[model samples]
Target: MDVIVIETPQLGDRSYLVHDGAVALVIDPQRDTDRVDAAAREAGVVITHVAETHLHNDYVTGGYDLARAHGAKYLVNAADPVKFDREPVTDGQVIQIGNFSVTVVATPGHTHTHLSYIASDGTTEAVFSGGSLLFGSVGRTDLVAASDTVGLTHDQYASARRLVHEAEHDAELFPTHGFGSFCSSGPATGAGSSTMGEQLTANHALTDADEEHFVRDLIANLTAYPSYYAHMAPANAQGPGPANLQVPESLDAAELTRRLADGEWVVDLRNRVAFSSNHLQGAVSFEYGNGSNFTTYLGWVLPWSDKLTLVGEHADVEDAIRDLSRIGIDSPDAAIGTEPHAVAPDAPVASYPRVGWEGLLEGRAADDVLLDTRRTDEYAASHLLGAVNVPLHEILSRTDEIPAGKVWVHCGSGYRAGVAASLLQRTGRDVVHVDANFDEAATAGVSMAELTV
Candidate 1:
């Protein structure tokens, strides 16, 4: 059997293509199908099945569209309340593809309808434990609802133990959530694919722990997930459209001005440094960088109904659109790659002052504001004494709450602080970007506080 892992680093999710010469199966695919198709073509096999472990809460699944396009059977949990037609699967149900077999194992925790698929040839075996039985930790159980947290945590423990007990002793485990994903309950202990044997000894949920302790730890560790998560479940339930790679038309200065005046979203997709140096007055920064979670921030801040205009290079704009489409944002109204001067020669340009951590400490004054753009839990763990906790995702909505003056923004690292500074500056607030390591706050003699829950 040949197994190919397709990773979407930004979403921290993986899709697998498993085949045995003639037929293949795709598990937990993202909205972009080009890679999957390419993989299938390279393998010289026809895709006969596409399966989703659950209704994804993080990004839109391309399973349905891929299945329809390839005329393959689309599989989902039988219990999920999906609006589209699918081959509903139950526990222990096995589907034969060429010389391989995929058996469904009901593992509900990440969601009520979650399933883990075990694929095996006559010899070796592997399990695609989507969101269950992760490398070291398990999937976050609180995404469904606050009240269901405890119950889901209990289910998570049971499900993880089941994978360890029922699957083959040496079954290679591949999970969809981990590697810096917000959907993970905690950080994974190891890297790459792990076996059930390794997990039974190392995975937190698989270790000998009581249900209460596991639930408590799971709930306590969940950081702030993206606000765009609210739109994913419903959209996935109804089945989102196929991926659209078409770039929007380039808007000239006149058209861009009209959109800005009409309150449309003007997102600058350049690097934070370029965006900070000079950008259109109203455009906000959603930098296209390796460290930037482009979709998460853009989806969190942009209203569902607002028309978006991407401003960046052609390649960058296309890449941004492709990433945005993963979360069910198929296309923007317009995109422009022209030089800033040529596109908006007469328009006003704005910038925010970027300062290092040392500068912030040396120039500290009583009247200045220090903003912490990390998650609430991170802020509570350890933060500068006087820093106000306003996560970068919520900065656009909480502009009125910020005190008037020079706001100094910093996150765990500098990436988020740059994004926050741009938003603050765009809103006409005097802002200073504290682009430095937050760990140095204590060394700089800044007062620190740790909140106890």
Candidate 2:
């Protein structure tokens, strides 16, 4: 038996294709079916089955559509009230494919209906613990509901224990999240892969016998996830069509200017520094990078109601559209150009100065407001003195909370600072982006409000 792992680094998730040289089963695929289809063809196998551990809260799942295309049995949890038709598999159900058999184990706490599957091909057994049992942790328990957090956390603890007990002694573990995914309840080890034996000693849920301690620590460590996550499961439930990776209609300078005036979203996909140096007025800088946290941030800050447009070099624009598609933002209008001024000729040009923490240490005016654009927990742990904490996700809604002064924006990393800088710049604020790592601030002699770990 060969289990091929498909990594989607941008979202910090993985999908698996398990085959015995002829028929295959896919688990937790992303919205892009092409990647899954390609993996199957290359493996020289036909996709006989597809299973979703749960309706995902991050990216749209390709399972429903992928199953339909291949005429495969779409195995979703029997309890989930999904809109689409599928082969409903319940807990302890064994599915015999071409050769191997898959045993479903009820492992709730990623979601109420979450399940983990153990597959064995006569000799080697592999456990597909989607979001339940991660590399060194488990999936976050807060996603279900605000009130369900405490209850679900306890459930998460039980789920992890159940997975280990049910699976084989030396079964190789494959989790859908926790490479860098926010779905990880605690700090994952960031290892590529692990076995049940390694995780038995290393994992928090397994090592620590006290369930209450595990629940408290897991909930306390759980941070904010993307606002876009709210839309994913709903989109996934409806069983959406395949990703629209086609290049969008190219917008000229005049049309682009008109779109900006209409208050449509016009994303500037350049280097954050290059974007801050110069960009079209009202264009938001969401600089596309490798691993392109492109969807995570863009999907968070922007409204679903707005018409989205992309402005960048041809390749970057193409890549950005594909990145956005997995998150359900498809076929955005785009303008391909290296020169921002030329792309939107009629639009006013805007620029903001980006400096390091040293710049603030060297010369910070008395009237300047130091804006810390990190999550609340991050700010509370440690932050600069007199820094007003307004998270990046809350920037649009909480603009009025910002004090009247020259603003110096900073985050744990400069990427968010650059994002805040552009939004603040568009609002006509005299903003200076402190594009430096937060670790440099203390060493650079910046006064801290608190240093409690």
Candidate 3:
């Protein structure tokens, strides 16, 4: 069997194209389906089946659209309350695709109705575990709801162990979430695909401890996930439409001002430095180049119903739109490519002061608040002395907690810090972005503290 792995690097999810010469099956596809289609065409095989492991909570699935386009059977769990038409397959159901046989294994925990597909073409075998059994860790069980976390954690452990025990020892294991994905309960020890044997030996969920201990550790380790995740389940349930990849029209200066005046979101997609150096008044700086978490923050802070406009170069705007679509932000109302100065000539441009780690330590005062925008676990592991932890995801709601005075913002690298600084500046708070390696704090002779509890 030819197994093609398609990865969405930004979200750290993988989709699989498994085929046996004549026909193929796509598992857990992302919003953009063109790449999968292209792969199928190149392989000279028709996409006969599309299967979803679960109702995704991180990004929109392209399974519905891809299946409709190819006239393929869209397979989903019968337990999922999805609105669209699909073939609801249950546990032990075997689907024959040309010379390949795919057996659906019910694996809950990632989602209550999650399924892992085992495909074999007589010679070789592979399992598309989706979010169930990852490279070295299991999928996080907390995304569903707080009440379900403990129960789901138990299910997750059982599911991981079951996959390892049931699947052939040498069978290739391909999971949807792992490689730096926040969807994982913990960090994967290795990268890319791993054999069932390797996972049985290395995966923490499979080998770490008993169910109770695994659940406890899993719950404790699940850091804050993206706020965008809240909308994904509902959107996926209703079957999100195909993404509109077309570049939006460029909004003139007057139109941009009108939108901003109406309280519409105008996200600036430039680098943090450029965005902070000079940007149109009222434009929120959500630096596109910051990191893969660009869409996560945007989806979290901005209302989904708001008429959104993106300001950046052609390339950046296009890339942002694609990334945004993964989280169901399909199309922006407009994209502005005109120079900011020309677009809003008379408007006052806003900028924030940037400082190195040493500079922040030396210049910080009693009233200055140090805001750490990293993940809660990252903050718990180690952080600067007296730095208040308000992760970038929680910044919007906790702005009231920020004391009056300059806010010195810093994250692991400098990306999140830059984004936080712009957000603070937008709120009229005097902010200093510590645009330096946070690891340099100790080396720079700054006081650092590690949380004991």
Best by lDDT: 2
- TM-score top scorer: 2
What does candidate 3 score on TM? 0.96
TM-scores of the candidates are 0.96, 0.97, 0.96
lDDT of 3 at 379: 84
Query: How does residue 393 of candidate 1 score in lDDT?
Result: 83
Off by over 4 Å in 3: 261-263
For candidate 2, the C-alpha RMSD (Å) to the true structure equals 1.3
Cα lDDT tens digits for candidate 3, 163-245 = 87778999999999887677887868657668999887788887887778878887887887777798898888998789988
For candidate 2, what is the TM-score? 0.97
Model 2 lDDT per residue over 181-206, tens place: 77887879999889998899999999
Cα-based lDDT for every prediction: 0.85, 0.89, 0.84
Judged by whole-model lDDT over C-alpha atoms, candidate 2 comes out at 0.89
Candidate 1 lDDT by residue in tens digits, 265-357 = 788888777777788888888888676888877887667667788898888888888998998887785556645676777677788777777
* Candidate 1, superposed: residue stretches over 4 Å from native: 444-447, 450-453
- In angstroms, the error of model 1 at 355 is 1.1
Q: Candidate 2's error at 83, in angstroms?
A: 0.9
Which pairs of residues have clashing backbones in candidate 2? none
